[model samples]
Target: MPPYFYKKRKRGAVSMNYSQAVNWIHSRLKFGIKPGLERMEWLMNQLGRPHTNILVVHIAGTNGKGSTLSFMRSILQEAGYSVGTFTSPYIETFNERISMNGIPVSDSEIAQLAAVMRPLVEKMEEELEESPTEFEVITAMAFYYFGSVNKPDVLLLETGLGGRLDSTNIAEPAVSVITNVGYDHMNILGDTISEIAAEKAGIIKKGIPVVTAAENREALTVIRQFAAKQQAPLYELGNHFSAAAKSRGEYGEIFDYAAPSLQLTSLMTNMKGRHQVKNAALAIAALEVLPLSLSEKEIREGIRQSSWSGRFEEIISTPKVIVDGAHNTEGINSLIDTVQRYYGDKIVHMIFSALKDKPYQEMISLLSEASDSITFTSFDFPRAETAENLFKAAKVQHKSFEEDWKKLLLQKMETMREDDVLIVTGSLYFISEVRNYCRKNFLEK
Candidate 1:
């Protein structure tokens, strides 16, 4: 062997610095989306199976998963338990993906954990003859950090993609939650609702309880088949439990949630939209199944306190700038419902962007119905579709394209009246960037 290669081998897999560790993990992006449990299983074994030690509530869905997880985390924390949450496509920073007690993991802690896992990861790669993907490594990081170091009482694990082969599926969660089945990730997940539901239902473990808010017949059938096959008791929405919105206004929606063992009247969720009622109810249902001692007062207080940023997040009062990460059809429809319910006939200006892989046209069409004016814009991401492409796909007449999204948004907002609304949405990646800018430029002031 050459001297350089021999020296590299001699150095061995040592712990890396923070920047080095992040870069090394990002470098695995080239490995792409290799979905399977084999790599994660191998990695966990090398890490002494830290995931096996933590109590997890595994959540999967096309939308509402993050919100549901947040609601549950808040409730759990209110019940006096330390909670760890693992979510994807973070709104602000990478560290936000792995959080303990609603606070993101510190940078130094992430670096330290990365260093510890580096050698083991390398050994696994060498043995498996293939490196793990970026998500797989991050999943392992969450499992190790939460299970070993942070030691939370419960971990809320959200699936990154399809549930069946997702890296996060390695855990045997106490309960599996599918918030709802929707048409997203068609390229990898599938083409139809049933196909997608089957993939999301993959999280259902044998003898474990499964909870879902999915209403579609096709989707429900798949979930039913899977739960029956796995012998997992299924608690479904609109049947096992239900939430009805009594009143909704600018403040928030008041709803009544009822399950067999628990009932709460006039529960309020800070998260706007009727869909949020269902999300909160699913959180309650999952909490009900767990053998934890919780009170109705704590659950109500927790749901009120729990808030997920970038989902109908109102940033400014005047001109009423709201940002929602409605990337898929179901989410966009929910956005439309909220907009119509709250804003009424007010003039609405929409700023939209989506990934090339998403069904932007369908989403644009649905959004157009709710907005008076639409501006198709692009974000600074590799997968972001250009403004021109989105505009060409748009069928709405009151639509324009703007490549310089920041300048366009600012210029447009300055021209808005008091009652007019500026709704920024489409892709979560796009929403994250715009939301950060809006907070610094608008909210901080």
Candidate 2:
């Protein structure tokens, strides 16, 4: 029998099947973001400190962390190494959060793991007088699953929040990566760039190699100071490693990568946007600093195969529909720039939505340049801002509101010309829902 068997409810904690397990885990979101590693450390201890057993490549940043991780995971896999990855917010499914060799953990596997861990979690709650945050619990599960059942050659961990107190930070990484810090989550991670950089820098473990693409003077200063204090070798993006776009267009981009140890010309990546070149460079630099040796062919092939959905992901061809997760100002600005670079002359129709707490107004303003007409829509998420509120906040000349995204999309698709394009962007949560709707309603048929 599995360790998860023979579980019974104690003090209202009930044993759950797959769907029920997901719901129960998500219910802990009400505990909110607690910025400390004490609970994570305690939880790890209870789980036999599984994190210590696995080699980690820990990544933290405001944006690009997901894309960078994708690149690294691909590269590692291409090198014939088994890899485990932990990412956040699950673009499409909950199972995606924990993956072994790029395959998501099955629903039954998650359910069984949740059942086995429920009693220990309840014990912690009883002792601490509070439940762990949803992210913390998921982090614990990833560590346990990767450490025990699906032990891999390496684990790629992306921080759920600021690095210092983030649950993922409990693991000691062979290489620590900060993929350019910026303002997003200001309420949780301070207002200034330096302050946010400091939070990201917290993942720089003592004597570990630190790789970063942080370009801001103030932010770079903070990272440099932290790395120096920790005596960690620092690899700055522009200084130690860099990528220059050779050619970029609708299909994909080719870039030249230059670094201290190696240089590759015309490295190809199907990933859209010039910013992705930088992200790929960061991933390459990270791999370079790691103890392992990999061939340039493996690196190139990995980058070519690396694709992160919803980051300028094109869903359709004629009157092309592109979906991107550009929720914050920084990401929105990047999206705008990438669109301008590729589809500047084309008239763009945009479907946008955002969470209430984000700087959606600024995001809207930035997105306006890439869009000729914009429709503000809201998803079913509790924290989603209403379409009317987003419309009012945007105050764009050619703007409208639609409460239902599918209806809005269908309505717009009818009028879009062959030369025109439709872009769906904003919150990752919103994009995920809208993408699913498109698959079922538009793509599948």
> For each candidate, C-alpha RMSD in Å?
4.5, 2.4
Model 2 lowest lDDT segment of ten: 1-10
For model 2, the stretches where C-alpha displacement exceeds 4 angstroms are 1-15
TM-score for each of the candidates: 0.96, 0.96
Residues 1-445 of candidate 1 have per-residue lDDT tens digits of: 0123212323354656678878887888899999899988888887688899998999999899999999999999999998999999899988899999989987776776677667777787787687888899899989988776767888999999989999999899999999999899898889999999989999999999999999999999999999999999999999999999999855778999998888889998888999999999999999999878998889999988889989999888877899999999999999999999999779999999999999999999999899899998898888999999999999888999999899888988899998999999988988888888878887542
Cα lDDT tens digits for candidate 2, 372-437: 999999989999999999999986789999999888988888899989989999999999887777
TM match of model 1 to true structure? 0.96
> How does candidate 2 score on lDDT?
0.88
**Each prediction's Cα lDDT score?**
0.89, 0.88
Please count the clashing residue pairs in each candidate, in the order shown: 0, 0
Cα RMSD, model 2: 2.4
